[model samples]
Target: MLAEVQADELVSVDDLIPDQAAEFVSQLSTVEPLPPDDDEMIEDETSENLVEDDSDRSRPVRENGSIYFGECRLLNWTTTAKGGMKADLAILDCPADAVHPFKGLLCGKQNGQRLRVWFGELADTDVPMQVNYQGEALLLRWSDDSVNGMNTQVMLDDGPDGVKGTHPFTGLPIGRVEGHRMKMAVWAINDDESVIDPRKVKRKVPFYQKPETTQAHLLSRRPRFISYVKRHERRLTRGQEIRADITIAPDEYIAEALYAILGITSRSELGDENAVGREARRRWSSLVGEYFDDFYGRR
Candidate 1:
């Protein structure tokens, strides 16, 4: 095609452009138009999906509101886990509300009902968000007298397990959960002020014991008390034993202390065929038991 402006001045080419001419432009290089940004993609396009599938890494988790079913000790944090303060309300009949929240992570059922979770500073490793409760479930409501200094109901995974807790009375290092036994938990208080079942109640946590002014349960078992006294004496002879705050030491009038604490005026009194000897034996045994409790704190 010829330029219209240049054709008008051309005398020789005027007849060649007799009819018409179409204008055309020549390319400087072979550059294509850039594709739309929406259509553009990286050389190595992504193949993985944004959402992930459940893998072995994923674990069962629990939370504050999680419910459970099992037989675990009801600890009272209201007074702190200083000693094993068991729950006076023994929930022997807990709910059989065993649930399998996750694979192989079932909370076993107990007697009466499933326990509602109330976590207080307990953590789970497998699932960070989900909660794995401190311990077991199931609750039976056996109401007793109202506890002293009773606090809120909840769960506590951290405790006197291993060498984690300190001794309440002696202020020494506690080696283990020495006096732990499973008991009932207080669930929810009935609005009507009526006694409710533990599983129905809705709380978690402990109880206490007395020995000084009150008689210890241990005294009821004469054989066990005698055995305990003997064992305690042996531990005293053992230089590096866990005898907490006992005054008498190894090879230091241990026998005398025993006799004095028991009030055994003579060894023959132990073999007393006479009623007088029997009375002395009884006196000494009782004294020795009291002494043991004095040093070892009531469980």
Candidate 2:
């Protein structure tokens, strides 16, 4: 009956008699709260619209599978340079007799006096990406999300041989169009933009040379990714290196982290058999190993 007390009864506390208090309380009745009619019916006083969905803004805009390719001159040659350029896009040599991932990606699009191709996967063909390579710097116009806003190439100087550029790999001369942005990934492609899995070809190395028991060709499966994440967290906990900033979280942000670290837009990319896909898988594996390895080693 105490639950039946209303604000008015509470206010009458000073006037209430101790002898009749129980009788007064027992005689009163409590009213139950009404359920909400509709979420939309509620009036919001704030100026901002808090109930809107805006996922599209955070996603990258791109034409899936479409890629632009360009050739770069082999101005300087160094294994170290090649390694450094691995993460970025560069015009690699793929002679007519051979199938080069870099050249194959272009799908024989446009060929002209383009010394540099400031391109990315679907890097805005509507407004062709233009690159200006002067003796001092490299400039681009009408850029896309693929290309970073600011980049400058300053290593080369015109030698007595008039701007002798070293090929990043062979240090020899090589191209009509040069790939600039490092974010662009070139997959082996055919006349169309469709990806070609070189491993699937049976003429060379038989597909079933040696297969695993329950072959998991894809490392990006959600379950596998989750396992890696849980393992990583455990390793971090054991090492006493969990972040205090709450920046890296598992489950909820697992997809976000995977995409960010792998530099891919889709999970399917993680399963692809191309250079980019392979590299992503390699990085993911390395990260998991590092987490456990470092934790155990410290002990």
Candidate 3:
């Protein structure tokens, strides 16, 4: 019976001899038991430790060095050393919660030459106007949504009625505004020529009606305006370039989000497969990563 059991035979206990059954039971008791697995327990403890460490430490936070300005108004236009007109702008609004290392006005100039002749008229009118300059047609519109009453926006290859037009400069297909759209407001000049008191004129009013003199001051909070101008002036005197560190990576979701944010439907419309497209994609990725990190990093 023991030999048959060792050969894998299905033998009943009743068929086994008493001494054989006793020997089988004794052998079973002598066999060693398998060790318990500790891998699962170790893994659980490691995960718990990781969660505790994460809870104890805060994620590193850094600022996107780019300077952003909202409710911007053109405070003044002055002649630069190269005879080009330099526009001083007041940043009336910004991300209030953000840490702005560069808090001030932004000066803009083009090609060491005076701005296109129509800019003066546009500034003076402060109303929606279409003007043809440098073989390109541009539509300018004013709004008062930013502050009490101050804002200006420009659209290219489109009229005041929001109708698309053929590109005046390219003669290629035109779809929407190209390059950076300027959102700006012109400074309001006082109408009364005899009254020189700057205190009497409010800075929040739009410049629709022509004033007696061309001289004008920025229409924003006095303190903020002064501080902005001073900061820019100091930077200019010191000859320092404010460096903005931007980082970007190639990501499909980031690209889609950027397209929506930029109000564009097709990536091809943005000159895909070209240098312009590559740069746009890079910038969009950087912008998304900087402003909307949660969305950018979402799985």
Question: Given candidate 1, what's the lDDT at residue 268?
Answer: 50
What would the per-residue lDDT of candidate 1 be over residues 114-217, giving only the tens digit for each residue?
Answer: 33222121123232322212232223333322342211222222332211232221221222133122312122222232222222222211101222111222
**Structural similarity to truth (TM-score) of each candidate:** 0.18, 0.19, 0.16
Residue lDDT tens for model 2, 13-47: 21221222223222222222323333222112221
lDDT by residue for model 3 over 184-220, one digit each (tens)?
2112111221211111111121121212011011111
**Global lDDT of model 1:** 0.29
C-alpha lDDT values of all predictions:
0.29, 0.31, 0.26
Show model 3 residue runs off by greater than 4 Å.
1-70, 80-83, 99-182, 185-299
Candidate number that wins on TM-score, 1 or 3: 1
Strongest candidate by lDDT: 2
